[model samples]
Target: MKTYDEKHIKNVVLVGSAKSGKTTLAETMLFEAGLINRRGTVEDKSTISDYHEIEHERGNSVYATSLHTEWRDYKINLIDTPGLDDFIGEVASSIRVCDTAVMLLNAQYGVEVGTELLWDYIDRYQKPTIIAVNQLDSDKANFSQTIEEAKKFFGPAVTVMQYPLNAGLNFNCIIDLLKMTMYKFPAEGGKPEKLPIPDSEKGTADQLHNELVEKAAENDERLMELYFEKGNLDEDELREGLKIGMMKHQVFPVFCLAAKKDMGSGRLMGFIDNVAPSSVDMPAELLENGKEAPCDPKGPTRLFIFKTLVEPHLGKLSFFKVISGEVSVGQEFTNEKTSTVERLNQLFIADGKNRNAVDKLKAGDIGCTLKLKNSYTNHTLNFKGASGSIAPIKFPHPKVRVAIIARNKQDDEKLSEVLSEIHMEDPTIEVEYNRELKQVILHGQGELHLSLTKWRLENIYKMQVEFIKARIPYRETIQKAANSSYRHKKQSGGAGQFGEVFMKIEPYFDGMAPLKEFPVRDTETHELAWGGKLVFNNCIVGGVIDARFIPSILKGVMEKMHEGPLTGSYVRDIRVSVYDGKMHPVDSNDISFKIAGMMAFKEAFHQAEPQLLEPVYDVETTVPDEMMGDVMTELQSRRSIITGMDNRSGFQVIKSRTPLAELDKYFSVLRNISQGRAKVSIEFAEYAPVPGELQRKLTEEHQKELATESH
Candidate 1:
């Protein structure tokens, strides 16, 4: 394999809504570049980009697949990403390391929720963008409408470079605004015949061409002067202006394509080869320590792993972008995250399942290495003496979670190891063993994401797993003050057990006044691990209770706090004062005082108007104006409190606070009601008191559970 210089390499990530034909476009690009003799389609399950069995089964891309085309004078590394929002992690990882993002707008839909969702990542990274209006040959294709929507959502930076003379059924010609010519493709659609603009379409093409020139000129002062001087930008000048505009995110040049028919793909590839910014042209990579690492082949070697894949027979393949210097097989680097030395035993430029072994990859190149013991996605590896690491990609937090258990109890340990491997591959899928809930929880982007993980576990890992509703981690707190006394006394043994404790319990807030009924001698406020604070007051005046015995009493109180009196939930934000207690010196042991204190705290808690608090989350749902009523109605049914409302890119954003209990499979519900047109993000807000009815029901259920356990 030939290695290209950083200046001659372009990393372009294809991203858009699902069914936008990104995978088909990838296949067409490879075929047009002569990297492949024949093109494949997603329908035929032969496209290089959708090589995974799961993706083939679903008829869509799942994982982002990398392929490269060594076009004339340049090597364009293409990262074909899944368009579904559930697989957005793949998109995010691809965009972070790419020089430009080619966003495909399905002509039929114009702009969709998936487009809007992926746009968030592109906007955040501020990467140069190209908007490709795909499926222009579909009967329902509407290029003009797609352009208008792109401008509306992506803003005025959208600049049209080409337009289909006939966009629907018989679409075969594209008017190139930059070249002031026409590209008429053969019905088979490979290389296009360049022709003069016909007089019939000359007027429209000239107008668009002038607009393109002006849009390009707006990016650079020199280009603006050149355009003003000549009333036009020459081809070279226009390319320079567009490249600058793209790099600065001031212009998102748009093109039209019918990827399925291989129409306009050669022109698209030509634009990428000639116009797209290379990694060397981009700004220096930002580092975690607020430093920059310029893409220099002579600089110290640094590799940032963006994706990890574990093949059934191939072991682990770590895909990375050379942030600096160059890497070759047998080169050694230390993983900044794991602090383990790893040798690049093998290197290959990936083309779907094909690994073309290469000896060296220079700066700005993307390639994969086999069996890097400690390296995984988001990890940075540095050569022996090189320090510092690349800034890690920030994956989105999970919006849905469920408890996962192996169908066979004996597979529990193996399931855990497999889950870790899955998390290593996709950081968006978080796994945790919630000790309180006694269940292994799997958190992911949505129902589809979790279901895919389950499918992989059962199919690839050969483990039967079941997903169940995760229990809400509720908390217990008091609403008022109350006092109670308990005596733990027993006379069955030679040494009797006798310890009495009297304590007052009250709701504790950050700045609440101290108790006046009993003077607090020493205050010890504990920050509970679950949430909130527990303040223990030493208030036994006149030595009514020994100072040493007070800790035992507090220990007892903590036990009840861990297992709340109402619902066996963790208790928080309360103050306990032991104002008075009696102890038989000989029989008053730590166990005796602990028991008395626990009993006293529990009794006082019942009288303190105890309340159960359920975890609440801040949920923001973005939906079209037409579907807001349905989404709002569904949210109301979930007992959601609307906190705020906003608008973004023609979508209405509804922000609400809802209890965790009401969020089970909430993503699925929202998808159904909005017909998959809505997007939601959830984050933990704060724990709030459950409604009276819910509290009553929960307490009853807890009592029944205790009754059953006693048997």
Candidate 2:
């Protein structure tokens, strides 16, 4: 392949729902461009895009694959992304670098949930798109209905550029509305023969032709005037007007295709090469520091890594796109994120699993290099003195989380090491060890997202892990003020120990004052490390217990706070004051005072009316109207406090606050209730007291577990 400048480079990403013919469309496109001898099917798994073993096993794409095809002296970089919601990170990162998006719609099922979900990302990136209704030859194909649904969901900007001439079982031809011509493909379906529209289809084609011309003309004032005068747009004028409209998102031309038969693919590919915006036409790269980095070959060299792969034979492949200037083999650069220097020794352009060695990758071009140290996804590598780094892609936060335990206790250390490597491969999966909960939690976009993670952990790292419910971190606090006294007396040897301490425990809040009855003149109150306050009032004017042992008394109180008496949970929001005590001269050491303080605090905490505080999540669920009632009812049954409700994008959004304990496996239950037509987002809200009945059960469970362990 020959080199092409930024002007002739077109970066386009292929996206759609699962089983939507995206992989087949890519295979047909490769065959049409003469890049491959035979088209590969998802069944046999010989296609370039679905090259991974997991993908071949599942018969769908699991990761984004980058490939390029040269047509009409233009290099088109096509990124085929996975269709599963679990791999949305793959879709998001691919869309970040592409100049244009080509979204495919399965004609059998129009306006699917996946289409709506991916469309949100496309809109977020503001990428100009071209929609193709594929698999028109399927028995259940409905092109007109699909178009109507597209217009309903995507707006009127979606206008037809091509339509099936004879759809269904005999779908062999497509009418190109822009050129006003008919393309008839052979029975085997490779290259189509161009022909004039037949007499029977002329009326339908004329109406669509006028719609296409007017849609194109409306974007450009001069083109509109010319269209009104000449009654039609010339070929160059039509192309120019469509380009402007596409860049402004005012036009989203819809086409028809039979990807399996390779029908109508050539026309789609031709339009992409000629009409899609190039790298030079894309908007400037906005830096984190509010600076713009345009595609200039003469500027400083900079590149960003969007994907990382570790092939069995090849050590590591760092896939990157050049943002400014040019980068070549043996070029050393500093990573703006890590401040580490790395050399681009061997550069290669990727075509699925195959790689072609290239000496350099220019500005606005995508390529990969071998063996980069300290450079990871969303990181920018630039020349030594470069000031700013390009903004990174914003991936969605993890929605599903599980507490993972090592089935074999010996694999605990290895489990963390393996998860770290997997996180490098797919950053969307998060692994955290919560010390308070004493569980290693794994989080991802959905169950399948984290299931694949467990599969890889076991298959690749040979570790057995089990996922269970994550424990909620509940806290224990008091409501009232109370006082207690404890005395320690030990006589075993020559130096016997004896000490006594009297302390008061009270609920503490910001700006809370000392006890009104015993208001002291000098009370040195210190805020607790986690929460609450500790007021050390020296009310003993005669130095009754001695000032040296006061520190020891406070230490004992803190140790008890670590394990509250109610449920063994951490205690917070309380004030402890060691007001007075009696100490023997010889036995009043730190040890005697500490023991006395611990006993006194425990007694007071029991009388203070302690309560358990549970974490609450601010949840937002979007469900179709048909399923909204059931979803709301289910939430209400789970003790949900509905905060707000509204309609958005053809779905009802219900916002509520629900206890974290009540939300275990709630995602799966919600899917079952909505039949997978709903989505939920949750975040941590303030902690509230657990219900009285539930708190009693929790305390009993904790006590039983402790008793069982002791036995």
Candidate 3:
């Protein structure tokens, strides 16, 4: 493969909501560019983007696919990403490596939930973006309504660069506003015909043409003055102004296309060639050491791995963007994060699953390296003595968790190793072993994510695993205060043991109260002593117990405080005062006092008001306006409190706080209610007390389970 200069390369990512025809648009683009002989359909499972077995079976993109096409003297690297919320991490990673994002909006549905989500991510990354209204030939397609929705969601920056010549089923041509020419399709349909504006569309065409020209003029001072003086700008002047506006992200040009029918794609290619920013025009900032380095191809080599893919057969492939300097095959660079030197044996430009090896890669280019042992996602690579490392993109924490148990004992030992490898491939996944529960828990964005991880374990690692529904980590606490004491008397053949402990137990202020009455005072001459004076200053001033044994008595009380009376769980935020005790010099030891202390704590904790605390999550969901009421009611039924609601273009955003325990199967439930139109994001919220009746039932159940396990 020949290496293209920065000016001839276009790195673009295709992003949108699920079922928005992003993959199909990519297929059409590739076909039109002459990169492929035939166009592959999603239903036929032969598309170039959805190459994975899982994606083929599910008919959705499970990962980002990279493909390159040559159009108008440029090599366009197109990345097609998943649209589902569960796989958003893939889209985010793709965006980090691409210079521009092409947001595909369903012409029939207008702006959907995922489209809004992808827009937010694109804005966060500050990437240049363009909108493609796809599926224009489908039934119920309304270009005007879709454009209105786009304007409402994306602001007034959205400008129409191309107008559809016809509506649904009749959509065969597109009129270029800048060129002021109509490209009409023949009734027999092969290539498009460049002709003068149709008589019927002359008025609307002229109006749209003037709007485009004015908008373009506003982007350039020279053009703006010319338009003010002459009442219009030439085609070349208008195109130049539009290009400048697009590069600055001041305008988001909208184009219409029927990706499946191969309509209006040729003109879209023209826009990409003329309007998109070249690598030289919009160079990426480089960071060497820690400070900003010049984005010079002649500088020291610097690249950061933005993503990694582990194929069962193809080893590990690391995709990265060069920040500073240039790299050629066989050149060694230091990985600043790991402090290890790695040599690039082979560098390639990835096209879907196909990799074309290149001898060298320059700055501002996205390429891949094969089998770099120490390289991982977000790791920076630079020359030795580089200043600081590049900052990595932030990923959201996994809110949903589940326990994974191997189907058999043999697979148990291999589970951890397999999961670790999986986590390395997708950093968004978190795998941990819960020591207290003795289970391996996998956390992800939602149930589908977890399920996919499990599926990978079985297919990729060849390990069969069973998923166990996770139990909430509930805690018990005392409600009221009570005072009690116990006596520990033990007689052995050699020595007799006798000790008495009197402890007053009270509810501590949620671990915030300071230790009371046990103040330590130090003078210049006094050394720290183990035993202290035991006085009941609340009543009689006289010592209630021997001062020597006070330390021993307190030791016993401390041990009991750790072991809760009801459950064996650790007790916290409670005050225990060792006001009175009796000790024998010979027989009364730390052991006897500790036993007495345990008995006293058991008596006091039962008397206090005890309750259970459960974890809650703050959930945000986006659904169609018609289904908002149903979703809200369902959340309420699950003990959720709606916090706020707002209309976002075509969808409704609902924010609520819900207990995690009540949301076990919420993913399936939400899908069922909204026909898979809703997407939710959750984060850990504060823990609150369980209801009285529920607390009682939980306590009883815990006791019964503990007893049965003991037997």
Candidate 4:
């Protein structure tokens, strides 16, 4: 393989909704460049991008695959990303490293929910994007409507460069506005013959051409002046103007394609090679220290690991892009994040499952190295003296959660190891062993994301696992004030344990009045690790209880707070005042005071109105207008409180606050109600009180479990 400099290397990521023909487009581009002997279809599971076994089983892509093609004078590295939002981690990482994004729009569906969902990520990075309207040969294809929807969602930056003369079932000819020519393809559809624009369509073609010219000229003052002087720009000038517009995100040129039939792919690739911004042309990458790293081959070597994969035979492949200088085989670099030295023993350009070994990779080129000791995804490798590392990719938080249990009892440790490996490969899948819940929980994007993880664990790791219901992290607190005293007197052999504690427990808030009955001597406010505050008031008078033993009393209160009387949940937002207590001079110690204080707090908690609090999430569900009512009904049925509603780009956004307990398998239910036309996002809002009946049932369940355990 030949090495290309920054100017000649273009890193592009293909992103769009599922069934938008992104994988098909990638396969067609490779075939057109003669990198592949024949094209592969998704139906046959032969495409280069959708190469995973799970993808084959699901008939869709789940992982982002990397492939490269050398066209004309440039090397276009393509990162084909999965379209489902569940796999959005792949798309986000790809977008972070790529210089350009090629978003495919399926003509039959126009702009879909997935398209709208992904546009947020693309717009966040402000990546130079190209819009490719694919599947024009489908019977239901509507090119004009798709373009209209794209403009509606993406704003006025959408610029049409080409449109099919006959979009549906016979999309063989396309009118190119930039060149003022027509491309006519044969029935077999490999290459096209250029011809003059037809006289009948000249008026529409000229009008669109003038609009395209004005759009391009708007990005540069020099191009605007030249266009006004000559009434038009030359081919090279137009390419230059469009490139400027792309870099500024002021223009998104649209093209037509039928990737399955191999029509218009050649022209799209030609445009990418000729007009798209290469890595060197893009803005310098931002570093952690607010500095920029220019793509200069002569600078110090730096590489950013964007993705990691573990194949069955191949141990680990860390895919990275050369950020500054060139890297060759056997070159050593320090992992900035881990402070470990790693040598690039072998470098290869990845093409799906296949890899072509290369001696050197220059700046802006994407390649993978094998067997790095400490480096992983989002880590940066730099020379020893380099100061700052590249800014890491921020993956989205997990929206769905499930408790995982190993079916075989002996495989518990192995299950943990497998989950760790999975998280290393995909950071979006988070694993936590919650001590309070006593369950190993797996958090991910959605149900599909977690089920796929289960599939991998069972098939790849050969471990049987089951996903159970994850318990909610509920909290317990008091709603009123109550006073109680407990006497702990026991004699175990030599020393007798005798201690008595008198305390008052009251509901706590940010600013509350102090106790007026007892003279306040000293006050201590403690912040609980779980949530809320534990205000401990030492109101004892005249050293009735020693100052040293105050901590012991507070510790006892905390012991009861940790395992609340009801449901064994953490207690928060409460104040306990140790006003008076009696201690046996010899027998009273830390343990005795702790017991007495714990018993008093528990007795007072039972007398006071104890309330159960569950986590609430702010959920935003984007639903189509036709299915808005159904989605709204579904949310209301789950004890959700409607917060607000918004209208955006032909979709309705329903915002609500729902309890965490009511949101189990919520996405699955939403998908079923909307027929997969709705998208939802959830975030922790605040903790709210649970209903009386539900609280009673939960407390009873906890007591029964404790009773059974006592046996």
Q: Pick the TM-score winner.
A: 4
Note the clash tally of each candidate. Answer: 0, 0, 8, 0
Q: Which residue pairs clash within candidate 4?
A: none
Which regions of candidate 1 fall more than 4 Å away from where they truly are?
A: 492-494
TM-score of each: 0.96, 0.87, 0.90, 0.98
Better of 1 and 3 by TM-score: 1
Look at candidate 3 and tell me the lDDT of residue 618. Answer: 91
lDDT of 4: 0.91
List the lowest-lDDT window of 10 residues for candidate 4: 383-392
Which 10 residues in a row give candidate 3 its minimum summed lDDT?
523-532
lDDT of the candidates, in the order given: 0.91, 0.84, 0.76, 0.91
lDDT of 2 by residue, 456-506 (tens): 667656678899988877888988989999999999888888889888888
Model 3: lDDT to the true structure: 0.76
Encode model 4's per-residue lDDT on 617-654: one tens digit a residue: 99999988999998888899999999999998888999
